[model samples]
Target: MTRRLLALSILLCPLLAACSLEPLINHQVVDYFEANDIASNQVILQNILRAKDGAPLHFSELASIRGSLSNGASVSTTFPFMAPDHATTLPRKLGTVGMTITSSPSFDIDSLDTQDFTNGVMRPITPETAQFFLNEGIDYRMVLLLLVSGLRSGGRPEMLLNAPNSSRVVCYHELPALNALPTQYSILEADEPCDGQSEPEFYAFLRTINHLGRLYPLSVPQPPKPVGRPFDLDMTKALTAVASIDPGRYSLARLASGQYQLMSAAHGSYVILCRETPDGPAVAGVLTSERDESTPVPVDACSRKHGNAADQHASGDPAGAAQPMMMIGEQKNTVVFKLRSTLEVIQYVGQILALQQDETEANPQLPERCVTLEYENYKGGNMTCNFGVLFHLQRAGPAFSSPLNAVSYNGVSWSLPAPKVCRAPTRCDHTLETISVISLLLNQNKSSKDIAKTQAVQVVP
Candidate 1:
């Protein structure tokens, strides 16, 4: 009976070791995760490049991954204490155990040519997503440029202020008498006394919208409180009042009189551009940063936090140009801009890539291009380009290349420029930061049938 019990225990050792294979294969699992992430980024870059070339856009997903793993286990029983302790029940040393886990994982990648993919990509963004980004303190300019498809307001085509003898623009034309905003993605910058050379249509529009953050501030509230009547909402009209106007986003209330009322469910939400002050009490107050037009503006990046009380004290247009009232009040304000679809964003980014490439080729050794503002009243130019700084996807020869962010397409490596700080893996690069936000938008627009990736790991014995 004693011998039988000892033999049973020895056999159990092998089974126990086999069941604990998980701890040994953790590295392999992480490898798979990283691979998928890199692939997703590459696909996005490829589409953007295609957009620049006027080629067809395509998408592919790593649908599923299956791994066939082989496990090898060896258990060798030794004497209880070598040759001298063989007779004793307690051995001087334990038996040797070892294991080797090898896996050949096969991934099933499917091209996104299906109608479902097209429909999902073409779907417009909702107000909720925009609101979420605003509340998160994302730059107002970045949000508007990426999401807004078209603006509905009265303004002159934006004008670019230029240096005295040079053609490059130094700032935006904020003089109401000199400029009004364009209603759509502009083909050219507003011709001014300065050099009239405009950037690509999209970049010009990008810079045009950059000024919108300073010229127009907004607040998105659950039960919106309008300051005045730039727009009106009612059963007869679709304009946004202090209520929900779109029936698709929120179910309109049906009155007892059997008429559809322009209203929302208790929790329904919507967007408001130039409606009210983005921060602080909605009453009388100027944003801490509002300034005079005599200062030159930094035209590159308008990345100041949109509505943070802490950041309020450190305010001025990146370009030192003058700004209009931050909040709307029965003014000729741009009420709303149509939000773009996922497909449109991809195309937008692609066009941007083309512009950047043109710039780099023109000055290969160009030490980070700086957008400037040459105000007529200001003596020196405010040279800054956070907008361009955030988007430096180095041409053919990648800048700040790493295995994590690099992609080999057509035998050339491509990657985003590195971030100045490296405190964490997330939010390390502006390129990655923008891409992740867009990716989140894509996820929000997914169809119900979209099978989100699974976290389960299967092992066949």
Candidate 2:
């Protein structure tokens, strides 16, 4: 028996020696990190819930987590070489083999529930930030509809076309005429009707964000970085400089042979998406036909040069003139559009949630602003819905879908459906991408990844 026990210990020594806990420890740490991410998403959703319930929004952040794991193994064996030949009590063998593992994890949490943090989150987003997100490749509709409060024409904030109820229906057929209307049209004589409420135009704006975005994207047209010193630039200089490049492009000066060369610069704000014509370059209202696919000409400025119908034009103000038009505002000028802050945007989502919850199958308090969306009952049809439709939260039964994000609030689970499973509010898998993108947007920072790197756990291998 003594020899057997010694042999068993010897045999187990190699097994114990080959087992290194580093990989296991690393995996534990990574799991902890993923837990924090999951919790963070829950926090974002919970705050959105607060907004929905009209409760003031609050936030908390996981500062860090420290975890330790301890492992122990035991082995034992016993055998009676032979049953007791004469013993009344059996000499049958009993052996034990056992292993034990234990873990303890600690967390450091921080609260952003303070006044300063709340204020920062609630502060209006700047034009620079709006432009930055646009550059980030967020869907143009998301950028415009969520962040933008409304158009700023003639220095007045006009939310002439903003309405939707979690239902993201768009009127693609109507966008061209909608985009063609001057920015000042909201303030001007109002030919197309600016009653501060128009269902068709709202859906039109939401429907065709792709071309509409290109036709009327936000711009912070910075003056070209001077190669040397700045020079007084005129309308003619702007036009002449860009002459050699293309009609729908901007102009800049490049150093050449000890002199500045006038040429078209790709960095222009408004571009006239035009189609070639025998009569001349007619201004295209929007990218509608195959002919409208012509290379868009960049318009440097909206200068008045009335003459032949050869000049290109763009999507706003006095839309056409003999020279290329900047086409930014009510009077053919650029203006700083407004963007909502993080808190405000979340509040809007809350409002939509509250509305969706309160709305009924019988009465259905949906506004006329959702007219275009009402055309939805058809499948295998054109895409009339907006990204919001892709962002769905279920008050019940999210567990079945394996929700992408979910949280326990007031003893109930609120979940945004896994894009992989519950495709859209329609509860079918269409595309499984945008809901994750929603999380990405919420976690956006002026510098997100860099800040994450600074916060990363330093694992010295």
Candidate number of the best TM-score: 1
TM-score of each: 0.59, 0.54
| C-alpha RMSD between model 2 and the true structure | 11.2
Q: Which digits, one per residue and each the tens of the lDDT, describe model 1 over residues 221-258?
A: 23322222222236345435525445434343332333
**lDDT tens digits, residue span 1-461, model 2:** 97776777767754664366667777877776687777677777787788778897766667667676665566566667864777678765555556666778787776766666566666666545555555665444555556654443322344333444323322222223433433423322324434443333334344334233242333323222223342455556566654555534434442222234333333533222222335544333221111112122224321222332222212212223433333333233222234566677777666645644543232333321111212232222332323335234666573644433667788988766554443243334222233343345445532322122213444332
How good is model 2 by TM-score?
Answer: 0.54
Could you tell me the lDDT of residue 223 within candidate 2? 24
> Residue 252 lDDT in model 2?
44
**Model 2 steric clash pairs:** 168-386, 248-297, 248-298, 249-298
